[model samples]
Target: MKIKDIVNRDVVNLENCEDEAIHIPGLIQPHGFLISIDADKEIINVCSENISQFLDYRYNEILGKRIDDILGKDFKETLREFKSNSLEKKTVFLTYNDQSYALTIHKSQENIIFEAEPNKVPLNEEGNLFESSKRLLSSIEDTNSLKELSQSVATAIKNITGYDRVMIYKFDHEYNGEVYAEVREEHLEPFLGLHYPHTDIPPQARALYIKNLLRIIGNIDYVPAKLYTYVESKVDTLDLSLSVLRSVSPIHVEYLKNMGVGATLTVSLIHKGKLWGLVACHHYSTKFLSQETRNAVKLYGYFITSQIDVRILNEQYEVAKKANEYVDKLSSKSLEFKRDSLTSLFQDDAIYQLCNGSGFSACIDGKVYSNGETPTEEDIRLISEVLFDIQSDGKVITSTFPRQNKGLGSVAEKFPGINFHMLDDTNYLMWFREPTIKNIKWAGDPSKAIEKDKKGLSPRKSFETFTENVKDTSKPWLQPEIDACNKFKFFFQSFLRAILTNEDKEKQRILTENLKAVNSELENIGWISAHDLQEPLRKIRMMASTMLEDQQRFQVTEVAEKRISRMSKSAERMQTLIKDILEYNRASSEEDNFEKVDLNDLLQEIKKELKETLEEEKAELVIEGYLPEVSGLQFLIKQCLLNPIHNAIKFKHPDRRLRIRIFDDQNHSKSDMYSVISIQDNGIGFDNQHNEKIFKIFSRLHSKSDYEGTGIGLAFCKKIMLKHRGFIDAQGQPNEGATIRLYFPKVS
Candidate 1:
């Protein structure tokens, strides 16, 4: 038994094998069973019909060499066993990835033999098709129905294989078929739910499928039916059953014949020992697949079928469980079992906890009773019409909302609603409940349980037994319901952020507008008050001028002269009051620009301006050391200090000369940007109660005979300080002089 004996002529390179000791023929299939292995259990073998190309390695080169030294590195141990055992015929069945192959291993005197044809396919998987298939299986766990599961599988296959189209074709006892699930390119039309008649494929074509478990039609247009030479019966020429593999299922031949398909790879889905369906992957153009690739795809098909079975079983369970849960949650809490109360069943946050349903609705008579979004009366009526059309016994239909209801086609304005047919009578038959909000009442007493518990010490003690059932945490968790219920959480978070931002911006805008209005009002108040009072003051001033002018001319009467003199003095006082009021208004309108002004230099200049008055009045004006620059309206601030200085000098006591001092200090207030400016004067000071009154326009504490001018000086000074975002305050009593403090913000 030599390796050369079984080698097929096509598989043997005579030129390369010239140095070999012997060559044996008619022993085994050449390419079908030559084992190639390396050290570290890395195996490379070709079970392919064209084995010659794969076994190009030198005979001696692979004897003791490791996979890294010959074939490759990091090969799975499972693959090493495949090549090693495949050579000895120890394993008659071959399993790669997940698909199992019933292979005949024939060992003759020369080499091993594998009696199985090979095929190739590209699983939509970009890389490592096995891993991709595993993920697809895991994701399929969430599939709800057979149709859904099939659809998921189709999509998964297409995604992993990068195929143009993949379909799950369900066949009946007859050859009739329907596309249960399908995934196609975006540009291609969907084949969902499209049914083809049984005669479309014919009976003879179906018989072929029974023999050809898996077939790869690489090029449908060029698929030439191979003549079976083993068939020697002349009378059974037209019978496809006589051949080892029937002529590519007559149903498929006819299907391709009608569809003009270019290529196809079909894997029969056999479940429970019965022909279930076929996972049909199609290509629109001539396609070529390596045998290795086809094997990978078959493995995927096997895994998908298993997953489908599990998912279908789980789906049945889920449906029953969900229906029971829904009935329990709604029936017990519903007011008088009124379905409309379902709208109030769950809070907004709880609505999102339900499932993949983004928005929810409960329809009565096909009319939406209530939903998360507002539904117009007409929309409700349309929905009612659709529900009315469903006369079945609470049968569920998985369909898009728009397709079910014409009124719901546009998702733009109206929120999409899913239809759940609850078999009920004509009267109040349907209740619109939002799926997103259903679970909310589960945690609390949906029907006034909280209010009922108010008299009790614990809220839980207040809830009814029915409420406890709904909130049972012991129940197993369902992902769909959770996804549906959690939608409310996102809605709440987003809504709060939007509203707060708008409100904050609105408040800021309002404040700015109000400040502008106040500023305008201040100007108008100043102008109106000053102008309105000037008229009376003008008349008085005119009368005084005339009285003084005519006093000597009309002096024939002494009593009359005295009265005229008094009238003139009073008129002059009135004019002074008017002037002071106007000056207070002017000070508010005027402000000085901030600049570096030496405090000591300013004080020195003021002293020089008033030196004569101070010298004659025997007043002493003193200033302290170097002053820092402070933010202020320079001219206004000067006027502010000047008014107080003049007042001190004017009120100088006859008993002693006046003393005035100006200085700055730290820790003036909580504000750090402000510099404190204080002036203290010892003179004839008024009572403490009159401090505020002195800063009011025309508010005179002293009689006209005592004071020399109108009482607007201090008021004008206060206005100047206020305009600079500053303030002024005075302290004084009867015998002692006053001290006035001014605060100004620094420019920098």
Candidate 2:
């Protein structure tokens, strides 16, 4: 088949695809049984056709019967207790008619579902829980790398459960998974190192992984119990997301049968609120585990997920340590080269290591410099123009030549890959990748159309390797490479300008004058209002307050006391307005105070000042990037950061706690020769039409009662940006949140 056909067929229209309802599956796995009860404590619904195996009553006789009549009053009361507290799941150890059984109960909608499997296995473990947990931790810690860790986890799980096969599956960017590590029985044909298409587990199924901790399928060949109800009630459909014995989709069951797997167990690996991957264990014949063992496996997975950060940090520290030393060496060497900053970087080959791309190109002061294989000069100009338009705050912009994205792909397909970190509009450090072919082996021919019926789309019947030769793509850029590009941007921007300036005193003097801080007319007006008007406002407030005290003591009329109170409050408002203006003026001083302002230290101080406000609002503050010291007036920088964060806490969304994330800008890298900081919050945002008006002095989008402010906070932020010879911009949506980005020049 043609390449176009292969690519087109592989794409799944997830948005438009019809989803099968799993909750109303009308069946349950035969190994276990399901009993759904209504709000009145009546077992109005019974799913299993044969219920005598585990319980004493018949499934046919359960409809319209009270749950207490079958499961006893204690079980009924327990269900009511969990529901009253709005809990989702409850597990109880009980004896029904003198026979012991473990019942897993949960309330869904107005009804309750009780999934019961005869608790056949004993609570006694095959091994000591404390010792097993300790050993698992030791084995994982012994691994030196991520790959080793993956293999070790598979082995540890296999040793714990003795499953026929165990595999550590990792999800890629697109949700497709590969068996990164595997341990299987000697007699089993290895499915090791095999890739699985996302169609094998649809997007909906993937989302369910996060809701439930573990899923088990016992005896794929066993008959499924059917659900039935005698009441004529129009009971709404149930949500089976947390059902332990929820019946599997027929298509998924068929896919497992094709692989000759009798039963399977899956537990999710969640990290940073996203599904990282899964630990899948398959048994060749019908297999069951005690509840204690299931809990152990869950604890093991949770432990591994918790350790992911430590593992990543250990790797990053090594890379960042080397990058740091290399950058320092380059900065010192650039001063000695006695050439343009970009020229020094190219001559020493420092830019190549930033991304490890096939080639390096630069547009320094409107002149192009390049090394290694690259597109034609005209093509380079065209690609650069497109990237420059979409550039973000102050970091490297990266993109692959996608064949599907209509907006980016149109310009991107002309080259293999592009990653550029711009210092300004005319100066940039660009990396390019030479075109290469990707030889990928799919489990089944993804190009073939999936089977569909009245039920829904089913998984492919075959699981054979099918190779596809993908063309015109370069080696994918990893996250670390992108991070390195971001770091490179700051180093080059700062050192390049410094070296060029220090080369000649005359040029340096001229550049200084051009960027010299100048107070704007707005600052002068604000300063006058703050310095000249505050004394009278304070006096007015004090006099009014004193009059109100005297009126109350002298038994004055109610109207007179109320009038005095209003006057005092108005004076208080004026006093607050004057105070805000004074702070704005303080931030507007046009002093060229060039010193290293360690942003992390500054941020800590800011957080401490806002601690009370943040605590009241239940705010969560997050810092995502490495904040470096920049050359600026320290006090003004502090003011710039403080106001926006304070605003975020003040205007937080009522439905959710305030989440404010501050990170260095990665988009606008141009000759302004500065770094931008972005403060984004999830709050009640205003329309972007008022974005500019928000920075105006005395501008108020909200009344004082709704959000108390003098409206000079952003004005103060804008002035600080002006004094630093930089810029600030605001973007927001009604009720969504806002981002306030302040750019500060890195004057070396």
TM-score versus the correct structure, for each prediction: 0.36, 0.62
Score residue 688 of candidate 2 by CA lDDT. 95
CA RMSD of each candidate after superposition: 23.7, 27.7
On the 0 to 100 scale, the lDDT of residue 674 in model 1 is 76
RMSD score of candidate 2 (Å): 27.7
TM-score of model 1 relative to the true fold?
Answer: 0.36
lDDT of 2: 0.74
lDDT of 1 by residue, 1-748 (tens): 1122122233123222222112222222221323332223332221222333344454333433343453233233434455566543332344434434333333433222234323333454346666666777786676666777777777777765556889988886644566788999888766666555444433434544554456666665543322111111111112222121222432234446445567787777776665677888888887655554555666656765676657666765664455445434543442422333334653332242244333344443344444344356676566655665654554333333444445546431243333344434542222222222123212123333111222221112222222222111112224444332333334323433554566688789999899878977976876687678778767866775676678767453677667766776776776667666666666756645666766777888999999998888888998875566766656766888899998898887778879998888565673476777888888877788877888887678778688688778888887888887878888886668888887777657
Model 2 earns a TM-score of: 0.62
lDDT of candidates 1 onward, in order:
0.54, 0.74
Residue 352, model 1, lDDT: 28
**Model 2 worst lDDT run, 10 consecutive residues:** 1-10
Q: Name the top TM-score candidate.
A: 2
- Candidate 2 backbone clash number: 16
